[model samples]
Target chain A: MADVNVSTLSHSPKDPAKGAGKLDDSQGNGGIPAVELIELLFFAYRDFVGDADELLARLGFGRAHHRVVHFVNRHPGMRVADLLAVLKITKQSLGRVLRELVDNGYIDQKAGATDRRERLLYVAPKGEELARQLVTLQTRRFARALNECGPGAREQRESSSLP
Target chain B: MADVNVSTLSHSPKDPAKGAGKLDDSQGNGGIPAVELIELLFFAYRDFVGDADELLARLGFGRAHHRVVHFVNRHPGMRVADLLAVLKITKQSLGRVLRELVDNGYIDQKAGATDRRERLLYVAPKGEELARQLVTLQTRRFARALNECGPGAREQRESSSLP
Candidate 1:
């Protein structure tokens, strides 16, 4: 899996705006978006997720676990099929993560009221508290970033608008 | 690792705003932040990185590769030590990823002009193109999300302003 050939993958046409090997020195070099903004988003997301990551790490849960508990907490009584669809993972893959969450008491799974075969998921009290704490840490970061961007940040939208 | 005890982890004092197991029926339920926003951020990030993820998957590269090529391309002539610091990974771990990238013509390393013992990193033409494509995909998402948020989005910052 680590040795896949990248060349065989479908490649997009070379973008004229992205001058090959040219350093981006200006905000929008001839209408090309600044590389800084791209880097900023990357770093911002790294830190944004890092908050939950630290907590999850201490609890021996990974990002997959966080995702499972988070969605279950957000949308109570969500069906297992819907979760698999939203997560875009195989049932087998989700099975491992879901089992950990359920066994740990963070999530409770029950048979669908109308359909016994369908599994409905809900966060337990413990799970709900954990999810809220994780969300609070993340939302705080978003709030801070939004505040830092300030009123002038809207200009990015106008400038980077698709041509 | 999945069997670690969550109860043993030092948890923060229960937040009054985060009511105990109360379903979030309203936006900002009594001043508590909406869980929907947290979920939005999660999904938004999932798709945002998914763009680059697909491209990387084809190349037999992973997120670490993306981060390496991205930073090197953004800040050409960055030192290996600096990259290691920014990535916060052990030198041995970086060695595997960096070696593959250099061997594949995606990155070029040269002895530092001032300090011959130091290795300086630069994205090769191939890398520059790949990096640009990935950044373009992600930036487009940011632009679209920012626009969707619009002026009214600023109100969120005002409402959730840090004391």
Candidate 2:
């Protein structure tokens, strides 16, 4: 994951039109949307997921694995079909991640009693613990962002600006 | 490439605790931050890059390529070292992507005028076109998100809530 320094990359305060490293400072034609916001969104997402990505890397896992654990823990007994719909990933990809989790004792699979062909997923105790830790790491970041943004600020601004 | 349906995955409106697809309705022990927020962030980022990701795939490129093109276009004449610092990726990884872009006429590399040994990057005409398109697509989404969130709503909420 690329950790961006948005301020460093942004145009200099004194010379907004001429960025330090840029040769062609011409921002394309008029009516072009703000590039600053676009880059900000890009870097924000990169940094947001950096924490979980780092943790998963340490565990020899990846984003796919993290998604599996998070969702399965969130929706234990989730049907294979529903998981496929939610993830929108191929059966093959999900199969590989599921196998690793089950084999490693992070997830448990059981056949639906009523529908024997149905595959149901559940988080094992190990998986639960991992999910908790991941959630905690993410939750802390979320809280900080909310605090920085100021809760209800968007709503208040909306109402305040009303004509 | 996974597209998520956050609303569908969310806890039921009728019974906020129980969800349609979930078998275990038990959200973990106390002090755990909101899972909905966590999932929302996950899906938000997933969808945000999805537009560019889809376009990149058509050209046989990936996120790495998109990032390279974007930053290079933003800072033409940028040294390879500066790019490395901004991206925080392994040299080998960056080298592979850069090779593809240059080979395909999407990027041009020039030696420094002052220090001929220093490699400087510039987006080729084709690359600039692609960058513009990517920026347009992303800007549309960003604009929509701001509209949906209500522009300045967050700021207003922060001020109003203050004593």
Candidate 3:
């Protein structure tokens, strides 16, 4: 990977909307979009997911496992096809992770009542517990950040739900 | 990775602070944190970083390369040790990624003026362009999300600067 040169690689044509014309004067006329905001987001996300990463590592699971368990736990009776689409991963890749979760009793798979061929996924009791813990960690971080954002931020957050 | 069973693994003791006492009655007696918020974050981050991942893949690089280039571009003259601390990755791992950036003319490393032993990193012209493009993609997503967050969110965001 170290030997690979990015400059030599072919790039897709730049989006016209994101071109230099959009650069604000504050961005040094360099056509860069909000460098400060970008870096802040990078750091924020790193810490946001870091909490779950630590716990997942302890359980010998990675982000893949966390995603599968989390979604299954959240959307009980989610179809396998729907999970794959939501995750944007290959069926084979999802299968491996799903198999482990099912075999470990972290998730349960039941044939669809309407369509026997389709598998409906649900989180087991243990999976629910782990998922809750992970969500709790993240919610705390978000709560802190939202509170720090100012007085009305939390109220807005509570009033509006994520779609 | 898929063969790993999370349930068979040894469990760490639950944090006492996250016990049932902390559950808001509004969240239901299940003690689950904001599941919707957690899933929203997962999807948001997945798409957020996916844009960069596609570009990096074209260059035969990965997230590690993007992180190195992004930081070096953001903080010109960053010390190697400081970068190591900020990235929280092993020196060897950082070395692999940093070497690629330097070899590919995306980063310039010079000996520190004071110590003459520490290596300070700066982004090259090409690196800046790539960094800006990646930032632009993410900024668009953030802008949309902020707008959807309702009226006063943007104002609060402007007043608060993340360190």
Candidate 4:
């Protein structure tokens, strides 16, 4: 999911209460909560991706590769075209990354079901294992954060914390 | 933020019942909660930026430009070098965005109090108006979301959602 987005900015006096930590920093303006949004983004994003990257690296891949792998795994036998729509990346951009995954034996690209001209994608057991591992790994961080936010803010936590 | 590092992908799955959204799609090896985390990230990031994008757009800037202005507004009298570090982008990458903010008269740059060569930045009244409009708008959205999630998940919301 790494794409060009400028994130993380230091919060100054505007925030007297910084209890919320890194994630809250980005969302705030002069207020503590607004600024904490940045921190949350950094911390959560970092912590969420931490382990997945390790597993992907061992397979000679990165998060971008994992993202592709995960989506394919999520939608087994999906076409390259569908993938392009979801990923919103140029073929040339995806080609190099896709090649790396395919060459590594993580993906199984077969002819499309209806359109023989299209390439359909699925994760090999190995790819599935990695994608599963990466996704599962990332989910833990989110879960913990959610839990920590406590039972009271469950719904609020889900909706507000994100957008 | 798009450049996900190899080391940072160390994320693990969290318990869904722990308060985060339960995945609605197929359990797919990683299970519903894990998948939900992915969706949550998507939803959160979208809403986070979406809110800001609209508010900033009204002021004649996109997210790229708005980000710089937002940060400066957050940390009044911020030093250029400090801003560069917080943003984690090269001076060149930021130069255009920063220049627009300055040239458009949303920000005021002065000689640093401590260092003559450094530019200390602040949001002009005009900039502050934009920032206030934006930050206030986002804050209200967040506040309302929090109100909806109710007080049941307060701790979790505070810990995971706020950050």
Listed in order, the DockQ scores are 0.09, 0.12, 0.11, 0.11
lDDT (Cα, tens digit) per residue for candidate 4, span B63-134: 777667676776677778767765556999888888888898988988865568878888888887777676
Candidate 4 per-residue lDDT over residues A1-163, each given as its tens digit: 3211223223233523312222233333334465455436544664566667787777677877977887676667666665665555688888999888888898998885566897778778888777667766666555555554554643444334210
Candidate achieving higher TM-score, 1 or 3: 3
| Per-prediction interface RMSD in Å | 14.4, 13.3, 14.6, 12.6
Name the best candidate (by lDDT).
Answer: 2
Query: Could you give the DockQ of candidate 4?
Result: 0.11
- Model 4: CA > 4 A from native: A1-62, A90-92, A147-163, B1-32, B46-63, B80-85, B89-96, B112-118, B129-163
Candidate 2 residue-wise lDDT, A11-124, digit = tens: 211313222122122332233335765665666666667788888888888888988988887777777777777776799989998899899999998887777897778889
Residue-level lDDT tens digits of model 1 in B102-123: 9999999988776798777888
Candidate 4 chain A lowest-lDDT run of ten: A2-11
lDDT of 1 at B46: 65
Decreasing DockQ order of the candidates = 2, 4, 3, 1
- Local accuracy of candidate 1 as per-residue lDDT tens digits, A1-163: 0110111111112323344233232322334354555554455656677778889999899999999887676567777876776676799999999999999999998887777997788889989888878877776666565544556654543343111
TM-score for the second chain in candidate 3?
Answer: 0.69
Return the top candidate by TM-score. Answer: 2
Please write out the lDDT profile of model 2 over residues B72-158, one tens digit for every residue: 887777777777767777889899999999999999988888789978788899998888888777766655544434545444432
Candidate 1: Cα lDDT at B31: 44
Predictions in order: lDDT: 0.65, 0.67, 0.64, 0.60
Please estimate how well model 4 matches the true structure, expressed as its whole-model Cα lDDT.
0.60
**lDDT by residue for model 3 over B1-113, one digit each (tens)?**
11111111111122222232243534333343455445555656667788788888998889998888776765567777767666667899998888988899999988877
Off by over 4 Å in 3: A1-33, A147-163, B1-33, B144-163
DockQ of 2: 0.12
Give per-residue CA lDDT, model 3, range A1-117, as digits (tens): 011011111111232222322434442333434554455456567677788898999988888999998766656777787677677789999989889888888999888887799
